[model samples]
Target: MIDLMGYADRVWTGQEDLRPYFSGALREDGLLPVADGVWMWAATGNVYVFRTAGGLLLFDTGDRHTSRALHTAVRAVTQDPLHIAVFSHGHVDHVLGMDPFDQEAAERGLPRPEVIAHRHVPRRFERYVLTAGYNSAVNGRQFRAPGLKWPTVYRQPDTLYDQQLDLREADTQVLLRHGMGETDDATMAWLPDRRILCCGDFYAWNAPNAGNPQKVQRFVAEWSQALHWMAGLGAELLLPGHGVPIAGAERIRQTLLSSAALLDHLQQSVLELMNGGLTLDEVLHRVRVPAEMLSKPYLRPTYDEPEFIVRNLWRRYGGWYDGDPAALRPAPRAELAAEVAELAGGPQALARRALLLAKDGDLRLAGHLAEFAALAAAPGSAEHAEAHQARAQVMESLAADSPSFMAKSIYGWAASQSQAASRGEEPGKEEAGWAP
Candidate 1:
């Protein structure tokens, strides 16, 4: 097994890069020791196992794809029946890995492990089932996996808590607290004796995922507050849902506090602009996180960017109008594009100008023009093909410039669509290079 602690030390001390951890490239396939009796199985999401005198305690199961492998890995380490399984939240990735564990218990004639989660978890699961198709479509686009299917079935928690719940198995005690962060049903598990904290997606080694564009509203203010609370816990070992484990009380505190500060800064800045009567577009352009904060390895924009967080804050505090009358009741995009194309002389002129802007490093503006050109041109015509080719190139540039995985996936997907259009082929049939 890789020396995870040594690697974490290197990463924390700035001797190693954090990209490998964020990308799960550094994660081992088997269970890795975390604390004295605690082992963590890292996949897209992490499954933390604590072997206690009573049996075993688990926090967050891996996703559907890795559930069986996770089960095998855990069993390899210990055949102890699972005592209690905690669902950190209702996200599919964190709650679907209990099947094999359940089967194991049955085989051993052990009682099914009790499942626990925040009270809102069931509601979130219900919402997922109701909007399965929509979730699948958005996730497909966001992850650059076309036609991806969202799972509708969910494992319901046997026990629910509104604020907090304490589970004691032998000498091990876990304090579960409900916190609003990436999801309303988020549960942070704290082991007071060992000073180990199992924070769900709340502190994934990236900029807090509080502003996912393709998802529902994330509570930025509440998320920041939760981080500040976790920072005060004096945790010595921090096992996150997504990245490598972090050790050292001071390092954990600094990481939590710094993440909180970033969220707090973005939340306050966006609110200030919203109160100042600025449009969403204006707020998006004006408000920015300090370069130094983003430069931090743990705070880098690997998944979600600060701009999306600003938008989430705006969406939370203000109406959807965005202070733009034109957008309040907008005309069809194609109509507007046709009008713009006419004013620009033609779709070909718009496409040519878009390519020039892209070459000049103005990809943001170029993307809009290229899209408009493609939309304005007659479908299947030579002009349409040319416009789509321009759009593909501009979108590729945009994707290349973005550091956030979410942004890159979206831009890359758009580029693929435009590339297909330019070649007179069906759009969305070819996945992007980054697609899993």
Candidate 2:
């Protein structure tokens, strides 16, 4: 039942009412209510605009249109040109929009703004392009899409630092701390003056994306430690790369503590499982968020589920080869699919059972049954509607369950598809694929 979406679980049960409380913002970037006049852009990435003794500083350049909003937000407060642009560890979403700033400055006949990043950022981009195929396929699974593409061109960073750098500008005294959590080149900028900590990807609104089930190695223990250190920052306001900002000293500390505890539990649990020599299935069966931990509103498992996090812990500590010998010399997937179909008494039988499960209030399991039914559907079989409806039911319930930014996007896409089927319309052009 838990294997329907291949990895999604029933961790969201009886949690429908929690959906509407999401404070996700629509715009890419805007102002942060903390520190009085500070502004931030909360995109699929995080961007911070800082006013210092020198001039304007842009931390993380968000996706393409970010500069327009940055300009607007900055002008409303100050008329200074951007003195420096910081790269929050160069994942494309955070840096691609630097061109806009460059263009804006060029129009005024100013210098191409200084772009600062850790020395490894440029190397990461290079690796991204060089291993585009690996990234595409891994991203496909992580995002739940079958086929996705990676970026073509990559750029090197201008101002690169090797270790830590202390930022002292405008009354803001910040410590730029580095680590290997979500990314090897990750950084968390701590401002002691305002007691504000700008945690890039190390600490986001969601569960740490450390175990993305896709790209490179994720340092789980280190990620947990980084959060531990962040909790000690005496931060009154916590601004992340994604989701709403968290303000208040106690709230900030509590959020970080809970996040760190969650990771520690996951890391510690997986290590115990490994020590006990438990299989993956056995380990997954035992994964649990301690009652006290899950009770925290900020620590809810809405966006990134705990199972994936567990598997990520397994990977980080044990390496990619999950030690399944058959996987090393496996039969073709199509052949395996046919064998499984035969064993299950054909696709029709699976579809029928799926419809039954769905009728019995097991929407998650129904999705798998419906998929197999759809895949096994004979061309021109009227069973198409049956499978489609099962998928729709699962999606609708999913929407009501969490409605996190990702969930809403998927729910909306699934709804549009169902509506199309009813109206005899062609597939939606913006068919929401996975978040690769």
Candidate 3:
């Protein structure tokens, strides 16, 4: 086959570079005061704690690894018992930091905090359990970190809501509104008295991750709609799940509006192209996020690239079929690769051609050609080694120059794989900072 086994293996490794992104991974671990009583602790994902007359209301619990850090950070500000907790979504990063709180409650002879979430969260947790191994493997590849494991132990929501739930922790009003965006079980908490909105993974200061290629289908239209509604709220302080707190009503308004504009523009462009009978590839090439929009700091493609989003959009409206007849019932990739290699004068010749293409700065196409050459050649043959070595160079080059942390991780892993294969290693399957 065109051998994704090697590529996947390459991707499941440690990331080589560290750069700032929306997620709180690269940021220093600490709690920052967002408002009078609301504090955000930066970790893998942000955990926000609000002081209420009843106790403390937490918007998200950091990942399982950060349980101690989260607990310590929150306790530093207030010793108030946690009376309420909410999961922004069901993603492992946003859902697992409650164990320390559970332990603390037992030690002090107090009841555990009541956890709240959208009704679909328990179902999302079920899916994670069912596909734990698969999710672990795919995420390892997706993040280029083989050590990362998906957590199986999840605290089910004691309070689940369908549409909206209003709670009163003393005089402060906590409004949990269900919105489908990055995940099906997303709840954005709105504090009317404070005029602060806690947007969970909705606007994490990056291009909205509505088109993660490796993840499940995202809710694009609904996400845009949610942003629009939030924008109209005229929130004075915005506390996103992963980023730093954003203050000032005008800034919040502009930020949310711009984010909405970008998503709406991308979705509409893809839909229009599809309606015009253009194939998926044709649409990908033709559709472009407006230059001004992309130029905005928040709209940069640092995580989910626009191209992947285009593919997701196609899947959403037109189904998986890409309108390419050749893709339907396609021959095994190995057969096609063998035929192509033969026509190119065997694998060595194909390797030489790929090297030339990469030298000419056509690394993307060179990667494909090099893959074909390596896969077509007999395993452990000199031809395969040479082809893989050349492919490794091309991938490393791409990774070095890429802007997005996501792209860099994937490309770097692929490069590592190719290099390993060149050394005759077996080809097999494999595996951020905060702001507001």
Clashes of each: 0, 2, 11
- Model 1 lDDT tens row, 126-167: 999999878877788887777788998888899999999888
The TM-scores, one per candidate, come to: 0.96, 0.78, 0.91
RMSD of each: 2.6, 7.7, 8.7
Give the residue spans of candidate 2 off by over 4 A: 1-33, 42-44, 131-155, 168-172, 321-328, 361-368, 377-436
Question: Which candidate should be chosen as best, given TM-score against the real structure?
Answer: 1
Error of 2 at 336 (Å): 2.8
Ranking by lDDT: 1, 3, 2
Candidate lDDT scores, in order, read 0.88, 0.65, 0.80
* Candidate 3 residue-wise lDDT, 1-436, digit = tens: 1122222223222222213324444334456665687777776777888898889999999888888888887787779999989999998888899999989999999998999999999999999889887787677767777656677878988989999999888978989999998888899999998898999999887788888877888888899989999999989888877655667788788878888888888899999989899999899999888788877666677777777778888888999889899998899788888999999999888888888988898887887887788678777788878878877887787887676767777777777777878898854455111000
* Residue 274 Cα positional deviation in candidate 3, in Å, after optimal superposition: 0.9
Worst 10 residues of 3 by lDDT: 1-10
* Candidates in descending TM-score order: 1, 3, 2
Q: Name model 1 segments beyond 4 Å from true.
A: 19-29, 429-436
Clash-forming residue pairs, model 1: none
Considering summed lDDT, which 10 consecutive residues are worst modelled in model 1? 427-436
